[model samples]
Target: MSKSRIIGVILALLGVVLFSAKAVMVKLAYQYDVDAVSLLLLRMLFALPLYLVIAFVKRPKDPEVMKPKVYLWIIGLGVVGYYLASLFDFLGLQYIKASLERIILFVYPTIVLFISRIFFKKLITGSQVLAIGLTYVGVVLAFSLEFSLEGEGLFVGAGLIFLSAITYASYIAGSGWLIPKVGATVFTSYAMIVSCICVLVHYSLVGDFNLMNYGMEVYGLGFAMAVLSTVIPSYLVSYSIKMIGAPSFAVVASFGPISTILLASYFLGETMHWAQWVGTVLVLVGVFFVTKKD
Candidate 1:
């Protein structure tokens, strides 16, 4: 691989590791009795200013003027990808283990493949079909394990995470073309900013405005999540996509499930059964095949 491709792979891997930490942080914050909306609000609230500054400082000079529909597409994708996807994830984490959540979310590679096939008329190879089968088998295995252990709300949680995967996959598929046109930095900043505003609006309607009730630990975790997981990985994934395209980026990020499982085991004291390990390995292997070049 060329140097830029190598760097893109490294960035994608690092971004997945950091993004995996988000589940652990969300679980930790839940320990403080914070609701999903409140926690999400705090995260976007802390993240909004950073995105604003970056958007201003990195604004492209003499940029190609985009049509109105392009701006609309960005906003639509921002809502679907970050705002709704994140809301589902946070709410689902309330019911499921972080490991299980990560495993389910990792199925986005298959989702991305299908989105490309359906919307873009991309052909799916035989290996890609095999990859999808293996990936879903792993997801079902993990889901069954979680269901056996935690019966209540397991379906709901898994369904929510699956929805999250679809929305996120849609975002990745759509952003593949948009990023090249608008530039990675500009695309990421604007998408994130739009998501932040959507979160704020959502909070205003349904969330309690009394932020003084939560302790500093909640705030600290939120800020850490915003900076470490949200802002940094957002840009890393964006630039990685710009360098190597979305499919390769997804392949590099196949490490996400294992990383989240390890983080959950260490931070939240969540134990992984031997079968769970097997399922996780299957997920990683399947994702590798799904996105790898023939």
Candidate 2:
């Protein structure tokens, strides 16, 4: 591999690891009695300023103006992708282990494929169908294991995370067209800014605005989550995709569930069953084929 490809691989792996850590961090914050809304609020609040700066600095300089419809698309996708997806993930983590959550969420590629098929009339080959089967079978395997282990809140948490995956996949499906119209950096920054605003608005309506009430540890976790998981990894993944292309980046990103499982084990003391390991492997394999270029 070329030096650029090597660097892209490193960045992709690092970004996946950091992004996986978000679940662990959120789980940690819950120990402080912080609600999902408050924790999500703190995360977006901390990260919002950076996104604003990036949106301004990276605004497209082309003479052509974007249509109002495009702006609406960005806003809608931003809310669905980051705001709602993240809220569901945070709430789900309160019930499920991070390992199981990551495993479930890792199937978004399959969701993306189905979304494209249903909405855009994209054809799914036989292998793609098989890949989908494997992915869901693995998820069911893992979900059953988790449900048995943690009886309370299992269904609700799994349902919420599945919704998170679907909404995120919708964002991915929508953003592909828009990202080229606006540059990747500009599109991502703007989408994130919109997401931050929505999160803030949601918090203001339902959550206490007084963030200072939380202990310092909660703030620290929030800041770490925002900067390390959200901002840095966002840029790293973008740049990695630029360097190595999206196909390679998606393959590299298959390590995400493994990273989360390891992190959850080390940091959160969550143990995985042997069968769950099998499920994780199946998910990784299925998603790999699902995202593999034809």
Candidate 3:
């Protein structure tokens, strides 16, 4: 690989690792008795100013004014992609282990594949079929393990995270086309700002701002999540995609679940059985194939 490509892969990996930590951080913050919406609000609240700064700094010089429809697309994506997806993820973490959540979220690549096929008329290749099969099987293995151990909330949590994967996959699919129109930096920053606004709006309507009066550890984790996991990784992945293209970046991102599992085990004391490990391997292998270039 060329130096740029090598650097792109490294950045992509770093982005995946950082993004993977988000679930772990969420799990940690839950120990403080913070509700999901409040936790999410805190994350966006801390992260909002940074995204605003990025949007201002990266504003187009001779501004390429897009159609109003394009702006709508950006806003719509911001809502479904980050705001809704993040809300579901935070809520789901309340009931699920971080490891299981990551594996469930890892299926987003396959979701992207199906979205393209259904909406964009893209053909599903044989390799993609096999990849989809393998990935779902892996998720089933992991899901079954979790189900056996937990009570009724198992499915509820899994379902919420599964919804999160769908929304995030939609973002991935839409952003692939949208990013080229708006510069990656501009798109990432503005879209994130939109999501931040949406999160704040949601918080104001239903969330108790008073609840934010938590211990130092809660605030610390929230800041770490916003800066370390959210802001930094979001920009890194955007730039990495620009450097290497989405398909290659997707391949690099297959490491997400493994990193999450390891981090969860170390930090959260979450344990995975052998079946879960095998399932994780299968999901990674499947994602590798799903992301393979034709």
lDDT of 3 by residue, 1-294 (tens): 899999989999999999999999999989988899988888998999999988898887754556688789889999999999999999889889999999999899889988998999989998889988998999998889776678899889999999999999999888888887887888888889999999989988997777548999899999999999999998888888888887788899998998999999999999999998999999999998998953
Question: Please, what is the whole-model Cα lDDT of each candidate in the order they appear?
Answer: 0.91, 0.87, 0.90
Q: What is the TM-score of each candidate against the true structure?
A: 0.97, 0.94, 0.97
State each model's C-alpha RMSD to the native: 1.1, 1.7, 1.2
Q: In candidate 1, what are the lDDT values of residues 1-294, reduced to their tens digit?
A: 899999998989889999999999999999999999999999998999999999999887864546678789899999999998999999999999999999999999899889999999999999889988998888887777776677879988888999999999999999999999888888899999999999999989998888779999999999999999999999999999999889888888888888998899999999988877888888889999998962
Model 3 off-target regions past 4 Å?
Answer: none
Top lDDT hit: 1
The list of candidate 1 runs beyond 4 A from truth reads: none
Order of quality (lDDT): 1, 3, 2
Give one digit per residue, the lDDT tens place, for model 2 in 17-128.
Answer: 9999999999989999999998998999899999999888877777474678878988998899888999899989888989999999998889888888899898998998
Kindly report which residue pairs in candidate 2 clash with one another.
none
How far is 36's C-alpha from truth in model 1 (Å)?
0.1
Q: Output the worst ten-in-a-row residue range by lDDT, candidate 1.
A: 60-69
